[model samples]
Target: MTTEPFLAPVTTPAERREWILRLLTGTQRVDRIRRLRESIILSLLFLSALISVATTIGIIYTLSIETFHFFQRVSLIDFLTDTQWTPLFTEKHFGIWPLLTATLLVSAIAMLVALPLGLLAAIGLSEYASPRLASIVKPILEILAGVPTVVYGYFALLFVTPLLKRFIPQLEVFNALSAGLVMGIMILPLVASLSEDAMRAVPQSLREGAYALGATKLEVVWRVVVPSSLSGIVAASILAISRAIGETMIVAIAMGQVPRLTLNPLVAMETMTAYIVQVSLGDTPHGSLEYQTIFAVGTALFLITMVLNLLSYRFLQRFREVYE
Candidate 1:
């Protein structure tokens, strides 16, 4: 083997320190740029979220101002206690209960149809249906939601009411039962889709554990899945109620313009939304009592919807399950 000469490495401490300082400076600059970018993105997201809050605030303020004007011309006592709602008549009555009672009746009828069918559909889709079947069926169910409310209104008026009249001869041409039934069908997808999603989110491990305990598939679904997903299921139901309450066209066309205090579902009845549509369709000039009534009714509608959502939130908080 031939011997080779060794070369000594040379580097100044000053150069070494300078290179290290440059590297640290670059890293600090990069970190600062990254932080700035992150801050900008966060700021944009916060503003985007605030937009909805601001819109809601604006609506509440507008309604409050107009409602104050309405209460000036109309007494709160009369509005609450009067049995009639002939606001446009020469002998005007503003008893809100008639409209309120009708609204509740329609909503109750709708829930009766929606809850069982929706819950069952959700359970079947989440537990029983094969993946391919669910994929096909879920979309078809949701397609009902995509249909225009106007179309549903027409169907209720032209088809459903006539069909019901055959069974119950007392049913009117325009009645709450038909509107409510179609409205329930319209809201069915909301309950089913949301509840099914909630049930599906339940861990497979829970089902496995139930099976290990010698439980049947139905038992696992009912005991393990349904109980755990109860919060979401309740939320879905509440959301459907809110939709039913807000729906205008179906009730307007099928339930008629008459506001009656009676509990019977076969008679023509008007909801708050129907009243609003009636006023909007009329030639009621701006700043008139007729115009102000819409805002007042809208305020009430807003309050009712808000209460329902709050109830949903409360129930969700109370029943929500924590899973590892």
Candidate 2:
């Protein structure tokens, strides 16, 4: 290729100055085009975001306003303080505790089962498993996620409940424990997959250096991999918790429509989603406060899940440290 400068033919000082000015102007024009494109793209994204936020806030606002009207008729103090939650009766008691307790109990059981098992699986996949083992096992783990939740609900109701009854006679046929345990299994892929990604991203040189210093595989994993991936592990746990909280069909079918204010997982309980399903399945009157109750429960559930996500993000920010 010819190596002569493009400006070589412009030998005169005047020509050089003109050429330089032309190049500078051309560069400025290109910069302007790039800036305009960036601004347009970003503005479109920002506009989309504003619409999303407005829609979300509008729903919350509409629900809150209607809920306030409901409270005026139903009494906020009683709703907050009372234990019973029968909203469709002549007596019309509407406490938030039963729903809250049910959601809490199911989520707690799910977390109890999912956390340790998923984390261990992630550890094995990232730290100990051979390539052949991973190739065989990863798909197997993911299969759990692919199973339809309705099918799990069916199994929980027919198979699991009966099986549990054989061992524990007092266990309810439809209980929080069965629902939570199944929900945990359902969300296992979320925790294991994300945590494995995080662990794999840890610097290989860190492991190599540890091994060079006479560290065993266990020591390297415990000290380096787990610590480095702590933020991601925590985030996975939080996400698993979120999934457990939001699961619908499994809890709806397996967990009975009994919104008890008890912590005992052996007893039947109804989650927020389950109660919503129960209420809607009955085809309750559209304009009734009972119909609007789902939206209120939904708003509360939304806030709780959002808080958990925010907390997870904060943990991610604090623990992530990458070095050159």
- Per-candidate TM vs. native? 0.86, 0.81
* Among all candidates shown, the one with the greatest lDDT: 1
Residue clash pairs of candidate 2 = none
Quote model 1's TM-score: 0.86
RMSD list, candidates in order: 5.0, 4.9
lDDT of 2 at 170: 97
Kindly state the number of residue pairs that clash in model 2.
0
Error (Å) of candidate 2 at residue 267 is: 2.0
Tens digits of lDDT, candidate 1, 41-87: 99999999999999999999999999999999999999989999998
Task: Give the least accurate 10-residue stretch of model 2, judged by summed lDDT.
Answer: 315-324
Point to the candidate with the largest TM-score. 1
Candidate 1 overall lDDT versus native: 0.91
lDDT of 2 by residue, 141-253 (tens): 99999999999999888888888889889998889878888888888888898888788878899999999999999999999889888888998899788788888999999
